[model samples]
Target: MSTLPAYVVFGEALTDFIRQSDGRWAAQPGGACWNVACVGVRLGVAAGYAGSVSNDLFGDALYMLAAEAGLDMRFTQRFDAPPLLAMVPSTQPPEYFFIGEGSADLRFDPDRLPVGWRSAAQILHFGCISLAREPLASKLVEVALAAHLAGKRIAFDPNWRNLMTHAAYRDTFHVMAGITDYLKVSDEDLQHLFPGINQREAIAHLRALAPFAQIMVTRGAAGMSLFCDGIEYTQPAFPVTVADTVGCGDAAMGGWMASLLRQPDAAPATHLRFAAATAALVATRTGAYAPCWEEVSSLLAQQITESPHAQ
Candidate 1:
């Protein structure tokens, strides 16, 4: 068995402060890239999240969670700065703002990562507000380019957040899109990234920007569509009694990327179904829940057996 990670995600790892209906705050270790790395590792891929976090209690919780979930911890770094945080004042409208100015996540130092990690990483995933912030954003972009030049697969999800301005994120998006092998975006993300444009035009814009990338556009509850090799494969969302969708996008991205790496020759529908099942399972749990390989496979198996097309 190799010690190398098949999937390496770069971005911020922060604590999410969700306000409860009772006027209290609850803290959860969450970040888009962290969630993706956790999901991938949980789903049986050798994965790691490369970033910096504060050497405080918040960062301690994130570090412990990553270790518990089997993430390659060599890629994690701790800084003596303030911990990054996502303050969520409301959940109904999905309102959030980050508090990480000069914080630890922004101080990510790639040079500190384990030596030879660049070459050992088979697929490098990048996205979220990490790409929209300064210092960290520029560093991550260079890292992505280095990974691309090394002939490694690139998986990106803009995972657009409210903090991103179209001007800043648009430039980063174009740069990453050009090198991305697998790109995931939500309909909501497209709305924010390409506002003043309709959904069709938005996707068209993405296709034009990332001509060779397999773009996965997810429409919650309505399902997802894949634009691959100039063909479109649409699949309905895997239904599950709803819980929290916070981790669905990460689960979907992790699932699809894992499928692609595991079975490079699998059909698009097969990949989409696997990804959707993984995400659906996450939606049935609270927080950024990561499903193991057995759980994802079991859900997929049950769905297949229930499908009308089952032979």
Candidate 2:
């Protein structure tokens, strides 16, 4: 607990206002990077979110939740700027707009991070709209690039959004994807990232972009596919009643990374199954729910008990 966390996730921490089917809006503590970090921590990983948030109640909630989840609070910063917000007016792809003209996420200063964070962490994660904004985006890119150059593991997930269609964001995406050691993208993201291209071509492009990286593509309820070591591995999604798909991808990424770090030499198939189960648990709950390690293991064990050969 005295040392830095092994997992460091950098990006925005915002409140999501998802409109419900009943014509009402629900507020949830969400943001791709923030949720991923919290998921790792809750999944029994030494993780922390390396970002800044407003010092108001919204950020206060995020801060308190992360702290209670056992994230080392030394890496997160607080600013007096307005809190960032995501207004999701629709579902299926989670269409939303940002309200961060001067949000605290924009004020994240890498210079203020703990002195030894760069060398201490095992993996540094970045993605989502965090790479869409300026100043902070460029700074995050620099941080990621530096981490890669130093031989530290770097994980990236484009986490597509409407704002990512910008020409500028395209350049940023390629830069991050190219340097990342681990790249995680969803089926929806592939369509947005490589418009007019087929899945095979898009994946080929990603392989060319990050030749040495282990790439993972999530296929919603269908399951997930992985391309690693010049081979392909697939894992089926665990059957679970649907609640909402929000944060499912983050759960997968967090679960994958947690298993990778915790299990060390576990097979890629086992890791994928672990991740799929972690995400499945989250889909049974609303918001960016962080499933604990016990719940995930229980689900996996129950699956084995129910159908020994299915897994």
Candidate 3:
């Protein structure tokens, strides 16, 4: 069997401090792009991560984790600064407080892109806080536009956080959306981006902005909907025990990307089943934990048996 095509994931890898019930804090390796890349590698895809990190211990841990996850670390750059940290309150839904100013992740320069990286990757996936920031945001847009012109697929998950309602970040959001080939957003994201607009209207509005892009809107627990090739697909979220929702969506994105890479002509139902199952499995785990290939394969097989359209 031929090896699957590789994917290049661009963005940050930082530690998240989640407030515990015991009046303490626990730190875990996170960053959406990092989780997605790790999950991709676990699912048997050759994945590469491109970004910068601080010389601190937390950053070193992220580097080691990426290496252990089988991701190519050749494009990663390091600096003497401390890694960015996010403080998650116990009551709210994953709120982040970026600690470092001009952190290493934002120091990426387009000229430093690894040799032949752009041409070698089948898909370039990026998103989350990286798209809402300054120097990094501009750099990412440059890289994405270059990749698109080179004929590589661009997968974007706005992963729009509620904190990005500011004027500057909102403008960058639209700019990034314009260059995407595949986009994933949540129902909350739709309303946040376009206040007072109905779901259908938001879809139409986004479609008009990126006419050539295929869009997927995830409605937590309820289901997810995908608009592609002049058609729409709505699939229910898999029923499973919830632990923490941190990496669930990233797992789904990895599954969808993996399926598309393997079977580019697969039906919408196939994509949804694979994505929803992977997401469900991830939700049962803690903090950005990625599922192995065996786990995803089992889920896919079970889904096929349970869903008549999962062929």
Candidate 4:
């Protein structure tokens, strides 16, 4: 049998220091790109990650987790710096305070990208702080643009963290949007990128920016919306007990990409349903934990069985 197409995720690999309700902290290996890669590999896609991975304890933990999850680490850039750290409060809308100045993620050198890495994967996913921070931001854009020119599918998620200015992120958004084939963004991201505008206007703004890309927007509990082939498909969020929404958006992105890899010609609604279901399952757990294929399949099956359309 032919080997499955590989998916390459390029961005940050860092540790998040999540503050617990008991005034304690727990370290979790997470970065938006890393989480997306984890979700893809966990969902049965052959995936690899390319980013600056430090040689510190947190970095070691991130590497082990990725390796255990079966992610390809051949493209990861090893650095002597420490891993980036984010202090996240346990709240409904999680807030972040970054403690990474000269962290490995920020110091990523795009020129050192693995030879033939661009053609090694069918799809290249990029986003998060790697596109929001300096030096690396430009480097990542250069890499993404190069990959696009090489005819590889490009996926992007604006993520829109608090660490970067709205203007900075907006600028990066435009740059990536031009080359992105698939765009996964959040309602909050739209609000930050195009503030004082209604949902219609916000979407219009995105359309104007990336008219060719299939755009997916996650709207918290309301669910998700997709703009593809000049048509709009909306899916309501799956009802699940919320633990925290820290990784819900990334999970949605991962699920959408996984579906694309498994079923490239699936309908927009079908993709939206799968992605929304994946996000709902992820929201049931804390942190950016990647759900296995069985977990997502079980939830999707239950949804189909419970839906009135099925009857």
Q: What is the C-alpha RMSD of each candidate to the true structure, in Å?
A: 2.3, 2.2, 2.8, 2.8
Top candidate when judged by lDDT against the true structure: 2
> Candidate 2's residue-wise lDDT over 1-311, tens digit each?
67888899999889988898899998888899999999999998998899999999999998998899889899899999999999989876557798999889989999998888877899999999999998799999999999989999999988988878788998998888788888999998899888899998999998999888899889998889878888788887888898988899999999989999899898877777888899999999977899999999999988742221221
- TM-score of every prediction relative to native: 0.96, 0.95, 0.92, 0.93
How many residue pairs collide in each prediction?
0, 0, 0, 0
lDDT (tens digit, per residue) of candidate 4 on 98-204: 77788888777666755666666899899888887787888888888888888999999988877567577667888899888999888888888787998789999
lDDT of 2: 0.89
User: Model 4: which residue pairs collide?
Assistant: none
Return whichever of 1 and 4 wins on TM-score.
1
Worst 10 residues of 2 by lDDT: 302-311
Report the Cα lDDT for residue 122, model 3. Answer: 92
Residue 19 accuracy (lDDT) in model 3: 88
The sequence of per-residue lDDT tens digits that candidate 1 reaches over residues 153-193 is 89999998877875777788899999999999999999988
- Candidate 2 residues lying further than 4 Å off, grouped into runs, are 304-311
Model 4 Cα RMSD, Å?
A: 2.8
**Backbone clash tally for model 4?**
0
